[model samples]
Target: METVDVIVIGAGVSGLAAARLIARGGRRVVVIEARDRVGGRVHTDRSGGHITDRGASWIHGIHESPVAAAARAFGMPMVEFTVGGYQPDSRPLTYFDARGRRLEADAVRQYAADIRTLNAALAKIIAGAGAEATYGDAVERALAEQDWDAERKERVREYNDRRAQEQYGVGMGELGAHGLDDDTVNGDEVVFPRGYDELATNLAAGLDVRLEHLASQVDRSSEGVTVVTDRGVFRARQVVITVPVGVLQAGDLLIEPPLPETHRRALGLLRMNAFEKVVLRFAERFWDAGVYGIRQLGDEGEWWHSWYDLGRLHDEPALLTFAAGPAAVATRTWADEDIVASTMAQLRRLYGDTVPDPTSAIVTRWQDDPFSRGSYAFMLPGSVGADHDDLAEPVDGVLHLAGEATWGDDPATVPGALLSGHRAAQNVLGIDIPVSELWA
Candidate 1:
């Protein structure tokens, strides 16, 4: 068995960041990945002269995200898109209230403000000292405190539940009230230039990465942790595990002497949400060359959050359709034919007979992949931000955890994964590198 200062498991964004930082410290590092490719979930498929992102594509915000800095450092162009560009449907921009009524401009503005204020107040309550709250509780409190007519209250509750579900995939019963702040905590969303996979590949460049290596078990009984991979056994003074939260919950990997009670409990408390996208390509721009659409289907919220033009690319007929919450979960069991047919039907309703049939359609099912059981992780209401600290803590001087799941403020964002990886490496080595210096 070979030994190194640290053995980072998984070559995802977080693992790559950890390996780079640790290796920069003059420590021997080995990055073992399960897939043949370097990037874990961040994969781009290039076929027929078209590039389709199979995994993460958005930085969410360039000004505040580390992904933007990484892109700048590599001279990659970061593209910006308007939030309104992502509408629920493609045509007939009709605003529908929770009561299934078409909300006028004034009503829409009022509802939007109500949402903003409620979210802000909830965030403030969590930022201060209090028991960890879930999104359900926070919204409930907001409703109780505010004096509104029954119709308005019903509208607000329905709207909040639908959007929150679409955002995280887990409905109110399963989602954390406290987790609502994860999206806007830092205030920005940016997409990578070229593709996010490019950033991952660039980061993994020149690093010693062992691909097609699946970690089956981790032995931590010894003075150091021993990782058992399908290819070989690697012993390291410290091992940074950056696998997805869903993978950990699946118990696919064996742990010697078992993980501590605390770690196991923390893993149990964490839940994975499903967020999937389907990209349809046509020969010509069908749904109004550059227009975005939002369609509300039956007050349950959007079956697809919205559609956007692949404005970054030229001569491309592509519309990226996103599904979150129940719709996403339901699609897990759906056949490809059914998903495409249903989505196309929705497009017809929005585009009013103008939507063209897609020549090629691609749908990503991350939930089925053992390596990445789901897209990303989100906290429940009671899991306070401090729980993130507990999750990120290095254990027994041997095992360390890092990933987007452990990122507190920036969870579900690329920058958060990078920061988590850097922090995990620093924790193992007892070093403190400010966030500013990491980007520097």
Candidate 2:
């Protein structure tokens, strides 16, 4: 067994950040990852002369986000999309109705305002919600009491549920009424047109990384923590477990002597979420550049409810769409050809028969990934943000936890993961990392 100052498990952004900062602080750190690649959930593929991210692509928030800090630190190009997350500015949304007729710009603005009003109303329901309240129940109850017409009511319901599924990566019914236990970092969002994984690559430079070393168990004794991996055993004074919450929730990696009841209960209260993305590359652009996002209102069920103009992002003439929660899980077993054709059907509903077939396509089914099992973690009915801290609470000063799931604010975002890593590094080593290095 080899000994080091610290052993960082998983080479995702979180693990890399911890190891990099620790190593920078003059400590010996080693990172062991299961996959051959280092980015983990930020997987990017540069296939067919196009940079398509199979996993997370957006920085989620730009203001005060560690991802943005890193982008500035590394001098990476971060382009702001038109409709940026939940705080989209005054951008034109080229939306259509279920009947395939494009909605008027004023109608679109009114629809946007309606959703905002609905969310505000829902927030009040959540505030007074009982202990057993679920987001689905809260949403339905709010909708039921609304004075809006049937069409307007249906549009809000579908948009809220499906979009919530994408955001939290779980069915609304399974999520806590308090939501994902996330505090939105106030700002616009950005995406890396070059590739999302470059940040990982930049952090990995000059670090000791061992890829394809799947960690199976973590054992702690009198003096130190020992990590058992298929490649070899690594011993360290402290071990940072940066694996996904889904991995821990499923007991995929065993921690010897079992975690404390608090940690176990916290783990049990949190649920893994699945979010999958697909990119369709066409020979020519059929969508409008002025329109930031395109979606169908009043068309419910597991269909393509939303799509973004990917062509504008990188000038690749592609469209990006997603399926989350139940839809993502159900689509895991779907054939690629079937999935492609179904998405094309939705496009035809908007673009008519002249809608050409995709020249190339990229799809991701994160539910099929054994490492993550799902995308991230969402709050169950009784779970709260504090549970994340409980799970992150170090075990006997020998084990440390860092990941998006462990972070309360901005959870499930890349910046959240990176900040968690920096916190772990600072906690384990008691070193001072300039705040300027983080957000300035």
For each candidate in turn, the TM-score is: 0.88, 0.95
| Model 1: residues with Cα > 4 Å off, grouped in runs | 82-107, 120-133, 144-151, 185-188, 288-293, 297-302, 312-315, 434-440
Query: Mind giving the per-residue lDDT tens digits that candidate 2 earns over 1-440?
Result: 99999999999989998888888888899999999999999988987788988888887668777678778888888887745353322456677887788888788777778778888788788888887889888888888777899888877777777767868877778889876446454566678888889889988988999999999999986588999999889999999999998898778899987888988888887777878888889989888777767777665335686788886668668888887787677788898877788888888888788999999888787888999888888888977677777777878888889998888766777877897898898888776786345423
User: How accurate locally, in lDDT, is each candidate?
Assistant: 0.73, 0.81
Q: Kindly list the per-residue Cα lDDT of model 1 for residues 1-440, writing each as its tens digit.
A: 88888999999989998888887778899998999998888898887677888888776656666777777877776665534222122223455443445557576667667666665666665565235556766677777777778767766666666666655666665676666565652334456546678878888877899999999899895588889988889998889999988988888777777777767766766788887778888877655434444445344445753566665444566877776667788888998778888788766665557777789888889878889887877776567555665777777878888898888777776777888988987887688765544445
Off by over 4 Å in 2: 82-90, 180-185, 435-440
What is candidate 2's CA lDDT for residue 61?
Answer: 61
RMSD after Cα superposition, model 1: 3.4
lDDT for model 1 = 0.73
Error at 249, model 2, angstroms:
2.3
Which 10-residue window in model 1 sums to the lowest lDDT? 84-93
